[model samples]
Target chain A: MAYTAEKPVPPPSSDELRARIPGWGADLDPADRPSFPRESLDLRPEGAHWDFPERQEPDGPRERSVEHKFLTPVFGTAQPLTGISGVIRRYAYDRFSEGRAAHWLLLIAGDRVDAIESHLKSFATFRPDNPITETGLMAEVKRHPIRSRFGRGRADLRHTWIDPILVAGPWVLTGWLVLKVLRPKR
Target chain B: MRAMTYRGPYKVRVEEKDMPKIEHPNDAIVRVDLASICGSDLHLYHGLMTDLRIGHTFGHEFIGTVHEVGPSVQNLKVGDRVMVPFNIYCGSCFFCARGLYSNCHNVNANATAVGGIYGYSHTTGGYDGGQAEFVRVPFADVGPTIIPEWMDPEDALMLTDAFSTGYFGAQIGDIHEGDTVVVFGAGPVGLAAARSSWLMGAGRVIVIDHLDYRLEKAREFAFAETYNFNEYDDIVVHMKKITGFLGADVAIEAVGAEADGNLLQHITAAKLKMQGGSPVALNWAIDSVRKGATVSVIGAYGPIFNAVKFGDAVNKGLTLRMNQAPVKRQWPRLFEHIKNGYIKPSDMITHRIPLEHIAEGYHMFSSKLDDCIKTVVVPNAS
Candidate 1:
C-alpha cells in the first residue's frame, strides 16, 4: 500500500538523526553549501492553490519504499509486480531504504532473474531468441574482429575473453540438463 | 478526462482523471490533440529515474488546442492550436533571460541542475505531462507557440522536443564547414542530429547503432552513412581508421543511459544502478573524435556520477557541449527549415496509437517492436 493523500509521516528530527548517524546533516547549515546563495526559494511565487494536489486513484497494489510515509500522490502502474522477481523487488522496497546498497543490489538481482524468465518465456514462442543473430555473433565474422580487438585501446578488451562463456555457457548448460532429463535412465 | 498513468516500470495505462485547471495567472489548460513518446521517456519507463511517483502521467512533447487561459494570460486565446516545449520555465528567470529556458531556476524546485520538465519526474519539478486529454501548462505565455497554419500537426509535435533538440544538438557542436561528424544512436534524436549535421556544414555524417532497422532509417531519413555497431569489433577504432586515422571532427552522443554496446557497462549502470547511466556511447564519442574535435551530448541522463572518460577528453582538447535543448529557442530556425522542406519531422513517425492503447504503445516502443522509430498518441481519436 502506498501513495495516500495524507501528509507523509514527518522525518526524524535533525537532533535524533545527528545522534543516530555519524556526520548526519553536515550540509544542513546554509553557510556550508556553496549554492545556498543562488538556491533561494523567495524567487518564485507560490502558484498552487491546493494544500496538496488531488491524488490519482491507484488501480492496484504499488511498491513503495518503507522509508517514505506513503507513495507519492501519483505512481506508475505499467509493470505490475509478479513472479519471483516481483517478490524480490517487493522485498527490496519493503525492507530497505533507497540509500542502502543492498536495496539496489537486490533490484539488480531481480532484473537478472527477470531476464532469465524472459528467455524461458521466449522458448515457448514461435520466434524464440536466436543466439547467433540476436547475440551479434554473425557480425564478428563479417566485421573486422581481430583488427578491432587486438592493439585497439578498447576498455572492454579486459573482459572480452569471458564474454562468450558468460553469454553462451547458460544455453549450453541448459541444453545438457534437458538432454540428461530426457534420456532414458537405464 | 483520460490520461496515460504510470503504474510501475514498463507499465502504463489510460486512466480516468480529472480535467486540468489553470492554477496560475499564466497557466493555460490545453486539450491535447497529439502527444509523443520521446526516446528519453524510456529512462523513466525502465524505472531508472529517482522520485518518479506512481500514477504520474508521462508525456512532454505535445500539440493541442488551447482549452482555457488564466486571467493574466494575454498571448493566447481559447481554441488556439499550440505546441508546448518540454521545458516549463518562467520568462523572467535569469536563465530564461539568457535563452537558457531548459535551466530556468524559477519553475523547478531542483533548479540547481535542470528546469521543470512536464511529466519527467519529481527531480524535474514533478509537473504532470501532456499525455492526457487536457494538460495544465504553467508559464504558458512563454513556452507554447501557436502552431503555424502550414505546418503538419505531427511536425509541430516533433518540434516540441525531438526535432528541436536534434537541431540544437548540432548547433552546439560548433561545427565548421566540411567537418566530418559522427553521431551515436539512431533513435529519433540521433537521426535528427545526423540530419542537422548536414545543415551545420558537416561534409560527412556517419550514424552508428546496433539495430539494422534504425541504421536503415538513418540512411533513408538523414541521408547519412550508417554503421551497425555490432558489425565492428571496436566501433571507435573503426571510426578512427575511416577518418584517415584522425577521428571524426565532431561526435554527437545521442544515445543516453540505456546504450547497449558493452555488456559490463550496461549491466553495472542500467541494471546494477552503479552509475547514473551507461557511458558507453559517450565514451565512444569521446574516443572517436579528433584531437581538437567537439562532442555534443543532447542525451538525457539522471543526475549522478557516471564513469565518463574525463581524462581522455582533457588530453584530446575536446570541447564537450551539452544541455537540455531550449526547444522554443530553436523554433524560429526549425520552422523555416520545415517550411522550406529542408526537414520533415513527421517522416520518422511509424506508429499512431489511440490513447486507450497507450500501454501497448509503451511496450512496443520500449521493446523496439515492429521497428517503432516513433509512436504518437492520439488522445481523442475514436
Candidate 2:
C-alpha cells in the first residue's frame, strides 16, 4: 500500500471519544473527561482542507495587526477644556497608550511570538477556565515594561499618547465591519 | 578525514572527507574514537529509507573526544570525552520542556514527519551522523554528555543509541512485576529490549526470531526463553498455548518495516518499497498479546503508511506506545545500572574493525557473516 495522508480508520464521534476516554486508565475520573472537551476530541479529517485559504472574505484573514495613529500633544499640558468630552477623551487616551505599549513589547521581543500566539489562540477559544491555556508566560513577557537603555526613556509630550480618537475608532469600526458587514451565512 | 560513505544499497566505501567544523553557536566538533553501525543503519543500507543521498555517512552510535566547542556549548569543553545522543534537539522547545525530546519542535525543519536524527536519511532531518573521523554536533550542551571517567568508551558508545533505545522500548511497555513479556526480533535493539525486560521485573521474557544466533544471544544476554518462529506452525497460537490462552502480558515489536514473515511481505515492503516495512511483526504482536495488554514498538520505520492491523489493536483494547527513544533521558538510570553492574552493554559487541575497512564491515554485517551480532568501527586506527 502507498502512503496516504488520510488515516485508515474513521474519526470517532464525541460519544465514541467519551466511551473510549476511560480506557486511558481504569480509574480516570469523569470530571477529568471534561478537561479534554468534545471539541478537542473531534478528529477532523487530516488534510481535509489544507489547501483552503488561511481565511475567507468574511473573516478577512486572521489579523495580528491594524493601522492606528499616535497623537502628539498640541499643548505641553492637559487641556483645560472642562466638559464630559474631556474626561471621555482622557480615558480613551489611557486605554490606547496601554495597548500601544503592549504592541511595542511584542515588537521588541520577537522571541515571544509563540507565547503571544498561544495567548491569541486561547482568546480565540474563549474558554476562560481552560487550564492548559497559558496566560502566565504571556503576562511574564508583558510584565517587565519596555525600558530603553539610552536616553530613549525620556518622556516627550509630543508623542505621549496615541491619537485616541483615530486609534480607538478603527478598532471599533473593524469590529462593526466584522459583526455586521462581513458576517458570513451560518 | 576518512568516513564511510554510502554509494548505494549494499554498497559502501571508506573515502576521504572534509573534517566537520562548528557551524552553529551550540555546535561542537567531536573527533570520533569509536562508532558502531546501528541495526537501523541497515534500513539505509538495504535502500529501504527514502532520500538517502549518495556519500551520506551512516552511524548514530558513537563516543569520541571533543575536538572543538562553540560559544553556546555550556556543558562540554575541548578535549572532554563525550557520547552524543542521536537526537538533535533544541533545549527550550515545548516538547523538550515536557521531556518528549524526540518530538522537539525546534530542531527539525520537517518537524511533522519526525524529529532530527543523525545520519539516518533525509526523512529524519538529514543531519550528518557520527560515522566519520569528525562530526559537528548541534545543541551540544543538551544532547552530548561527558562520559564518566570510569565507564568504558565501548559501553558509552552503546549508550548513545542501541542500549538506550532497547531499554526505552521495554520502559514504554509499562511492564509490572511478574508480567509475561514477548519481544519480536532478535537484532541488536531486540536483544537490548529482551535484556531490558529483565530489568523491568518481567516474570518470564520470551524472544521470537528466525535466526538461531540472535536467539542464542537473547537467551544468554537477557536470560530469557527464546523461540525460533520459523519452527512454529502458527506463532500466535504457539504463544497462546504457552501462556495458558491468555497470551503474553506485554508484546514488543522490535522489527520494523523489513520484517521477514514471508516472501510477499519481504518483496513488497522491503524490496519494492511499496508499504512501510511489512506489519507482520506488529500484527503478530497485536494477535499474540492478551486483550488490554500494552504493546511497545521501538522499530525504525519510514515516515509513511504501513499495513498494520489497527482494528485488531483497537478491538483488543491494547495500549500501543511508540516513539523514537529519547536517548538522553535514559542516561542517568543507565549510568547507575552500568555502575552497579546490572548490565554490561559492551558484551554484545562481537566484532571490531578499523574505519578504513568499514565497507567490508557493512558487507559482513548485512550478510550476517561471521555471526556478526554487532560491529564497532574504530575511526582513529591507521
Candidate 3:
C-alpha cells in the first residue's frame, strides 16, 4: 500500500467543537470540558507515511469532575507543585467551602433559596478550560442575600475558631513591636 | 540515517531519516548497537494503542554506545556503552524520588497516563525509540546505566525492559520461601517472570499459555510446570483443581490487552476497543489465585477503562500490586543474578536481523513464524 505523510489540520472554532462533540464530563456543558492547545508541530517519524487523517484535536485534559477527582486533571501543561507552599495552597483550594452559605445554619428560607439559585446561575457561562475562573462564580454565590446572615464578607477566609487570628498573630506582633520600638524614644 | 517507521497497522518500513540531535540538556544521543522487539510492541503493530501517528518508530528495548552527551548529562560520557531503562524519568520528581520511575512526573507532556517511553507511540512521550541508527536518551544520568564489562550486550539489552519487567512481576508478588506462584502467558516477559520466580523462593511455578512451543520453553528455561490452556475446558478451573481448590498463593499477569479467551470478550475488548484489552488473563488470575493472595501485573495495558473484576478481588481480599516496572530499581539485583548464572535473558532470542529487515522481523514475530520467540535488530549491520 502506498503511504504519504499527512500534515495535521487546524483546530476548529470553539463553536464547531462544541457542536460536534457532546459534553464529556458529569456536568453536561461544553464549557466544563477541559481544552487542549492547538497542534503546532509535526513530530511524525521521518520517511514514515500513511494515509490516516491527522488527529483533528489533541486529547482533552484528563477527566477531573467530582466523581473523577481521583484521576489526574491533565491540562495542556503539567502542573508542578512550586514547593511546600504550593502543596498547602492546593490543599486550601480543594477544601475551600466557607464562601458558600451552606456553612451557615440560621439563614432565612428565602435567602437560602437565593444562594442556591445564584450558584446554578453561575454555571450558565462556566468555561472548563479556565477552571480557576469557576472560583469567581463561587465567589458570586458567596454574595447571595442568605450568606449575609452569617455576618462575614463573601471573601472571608475559610478558618475554624481562632485560626485566622492565630495566623495573623505573628504579623500583628511584628506591627506592634515596630510601633513600640519606633515610638518617640522619650 | 535509516530508521524504521510505522506506516499503519501491520505496516512498517526502513527509510532514510535525519539523525536525531540533543533536544534537551540532559539528552545523550546513543548509536544503537542492538535493540529487541518486545511483545508489548505488538499493541502498536495491531493498532491497539491510540495516537500512534504514521511515521512513528516503535521500540523501547534497546542498548547502545553513547555517540554524544549534552552538557548536563552527568554520569555518562561520549563512547560509553549504556543500557537505558524503558521509562524516561527525571530523577527528582516526587514519583521518581520514591522510585516510581515509570510514573515520573516530568518528561512526558501527557504524563497523566504514562511516563515517557521511547518510540512506543505519541501517548508514551513521543520520544523516538532506538530501533534505528540512534536514539536520544533523556535524563541520561537517571535512566541509563553503564554496561558492566563482564555483562553480555544482548543481556544488557534485555535488561532495558523485558527482563527487568519480568523480574519486577515476581518481586511484587511478595513470594514467601515456599509460595506457589502461577504466571500467565509464556512470552518473553512471562518466561522471564517464571524464571525469576524460582529465584524468589517460589516452591512451585506454573506458566500458562496456549502456544505449545512457548510452554515448552517455559518448562525448559524457567524449570517450571507448564499448562496449555487450549487443552483444558476451563483453564482457571484446572488451575484451582491443581492447587487443591484453594488456588495458587500468587498469580502474575504477564499478558496485557489482546489476551484471547472468551470470544465475546475478545470482540468487545480487543477488536471493538470497547473496553481495555480483554481482561481474559486478569480475570483468570483473580479466579485462580487463593483468597487474599497477591496478583502482580506487569503486562502493559491502556490508560483507559478496563472491565476488571474489581468486585471479585475486593470480596476475595486480594492485593493487586501493579505498575509499569520501575526498570532502574531492579538493575542491581538483576546484575547480581546475571553474574551468578541464575537467569540468562538472552537465551530467548531466536532471530537476529539487521534494522533494514526489522519489518520482516516484526511480521515473523507477530505471525509466530518459525516458532519465533524473540528477534533482535542490528542498526549498523552490513
Candidate 4:
C-alpha cells in the first residue's frame, strides 16, 4: 500500500510480537544460531563510487514492506496490485514483518485467490482452461500409469488415489453447473 | 524498448522500458538476441525472494549482440555476438581472483553472500536483466565472452547459466571415478548435473523427482536411472536399501526453496514462509547419502532460517559444499565438451517464446504447463 519515498511507519515492537505469538524470536539468542559467529557485519569497503545508485523512477504505486525504511532505489513495475488478492498481499506487507508466518501465509492465500481470478478471466476469452491436456492427464495414461505406481517405492503413492479428484474435481463441478444452466428449463 | 517486468507475485507483463546505456568505463550495452527463463526465476515469480521490486526485469540467462561498449572495454566490439555470464562481478575482487565469480565482493551492496546477478533483484545488485530488447552489462571485459562462431546461439545461451551451473555442481562434488551419485531434481541444472556426472566417471547416476515427464527427460537426456519420489514410502530409506545400506557416495540437491515432499515443511516454508525455503530436497540429500559422503548443493535459497538437517549432516560426518556457480571458470572445459558432441545444452529447451509473450512464458513455466522443461525468449523476433 505504501508507495511513498518517505520512511514507513515502524513495525510492532518485539515485546508486543512475543506477547501475541507463540515461539516468537526463538533464534534471537546468538547461542542458538550456528551462523552467529560468521554473521559479523564487518562492512568491508565495496568499491562503488556513488553514495546511492540512481533510482529507477516508479511508474506506478509499488509495494513496500513496513519493516523497510523506504523502497529500494529501483523497483519492479511489471505487475501491479489488483483485485482482492492485491489487498491481502498489501495487508501482509503492511502488518507483518518478513519474519512473521502470517505475512507469507496471507501471501500464499493471495496467490490462490489470484489463480481463481485467472480462471474466471479465462472464461471471458474464446479459449477457457482445458484441464485435460493442460493437466497432463493424457500423458499419465500413456506413460506407464499402473506400472509406475504399483511396485515403485514412490513416496507419493499414499496420496496418488486422491490426486485425480484434487485435479479434476473443480472442472467436473463447473462442467455440471454449465450443463444444468443449458438444460433448456427441463 | 520493451522488456519483461515484474508486477507482483505470479504476475508479469511486457512493457515499454528505457534503452540501456553504458554507465561505467567497463560497461557494455547488449541488444538481447535470446534470453531464457531459469527455474530459479520461479522463486521470484512465487514472491519468495526479499526486496523484489515491481517493474524490474526478470532474466539472468541470455546471449546477445554487443551494441555499445564503455571506453575501457577492450575484448569486445560493437556487433559482436556475445554470451554473458549471469554473475556480474569485477574480475579483480578477492573472490573473483580465486575464480569465485559468484561471490565477488564489489558488485552487490545489499549482501556479502552472493555477487551481482542480472534481473535477480536488488539483493544481487540491481542490474536490469536481458529479457528485453537491450540490457546494460557491467564489467563487460570480464563477464561477456564472444560466442564461438561455430557454436549455435541456442547452445551458447545454455552455457550462460544452466549447463555451467550443472557442470559446477558435479565438479564440486569431488567425485571419485566410479562413484554412485544421486541427484535430487530433474530441472535443466539437475539434468546437466546427471549428464556431467558421467564425464566425471560416475559409475551409476540416479535422478529423482515427482514429475514423470521430467523423470523421463532425466533418463533420455542424462542417460541416468530415474525414479519418482512420490511412489516411495520413504525415499531416503529407498536410497539406503538400493545402495546396499551404505547410501549414495555423493548427493546433489538441485531443488531449492519450494521443494515439495514433506507436507509440514512445505506449509512452513513455501506457504507460511516461516523458514526461508523448504529444506525437503536438502534433508533428503543429507539423509540419503552415506556417512562421510560428499553432498553438493547448487540450489538457491534465501538468506534466512531454513530447517536444514544440520545435526544429521554433522552426525553423519558428511562434507557439504555449495555456492553460486562461477560460470566463466567452467567454460573452457564446457566449450570442449560441446564442441566434441559429448553434450548438447540446447536439447533441454522445450519452448521458444517471443519477448512480447514472455508473461505467458513465465506463467507456463511456473505452472509446469505444457511439459515445459526450459523456455528461451527471442527478443525482437520477426
Which is the leading candidate under TM-score?
4
lDDT of 1 by residue, B280-356 (tens): 99999999998889999998886656899999999999999998987886777677677766789899898898887
After superposing candidate 3, which stretches have Cα over 4 Å from the reference?
A1-186
Off by over 4 Å in 2: A1-186
Q: Candidate 4, residues B1-382: lDDT per residue as tens digits?
A: 9988765555677767878776667678999999999999988776677646556798999999999997767788999999999988776655665566787666664445557899987557667798999999887777899998999999999999999899788877767655788999999999998888777666668999987879999998888888888778899999887776778989999989978889778766765567779999999999999889999999888656799989999999999999888787667777877877778999999989888777667756665656779999999897
TM-score of chain A of 1: 0.62
Q: Give lDDT tens digits, candidate 2, residues B182-296.
A: 9998888888888777666666789998767778898888776898887788999999888767778899899888786665666667655666587888989999998899999
Candidate 1 docking class: incorrect
Superposed Cα RMSD, model 2? 25.2
**Scoring model 3 with DockQ, what do you get?**
0.01
Ranking the candidates on lDDT from highest down gives 4, 1, 3, 2
lDDT of each: 0.74, 0.66, 0.66, 0.75
Cα deviation in Å at residue B159, candidate 3?
0.6
Over 4 Å off, model 4? A1-186
Instruction: Encode model 1's per-residue lDDT on A1-186: one tens digit a residue.
Output: 243543122233546544533333332333332222322443232233333433445457767655545554433233456677778877877787656666666765665565566567757977455454333243345334565455534333444455456556666998999999999999
Better of 1 and 3 by DockQ: 1
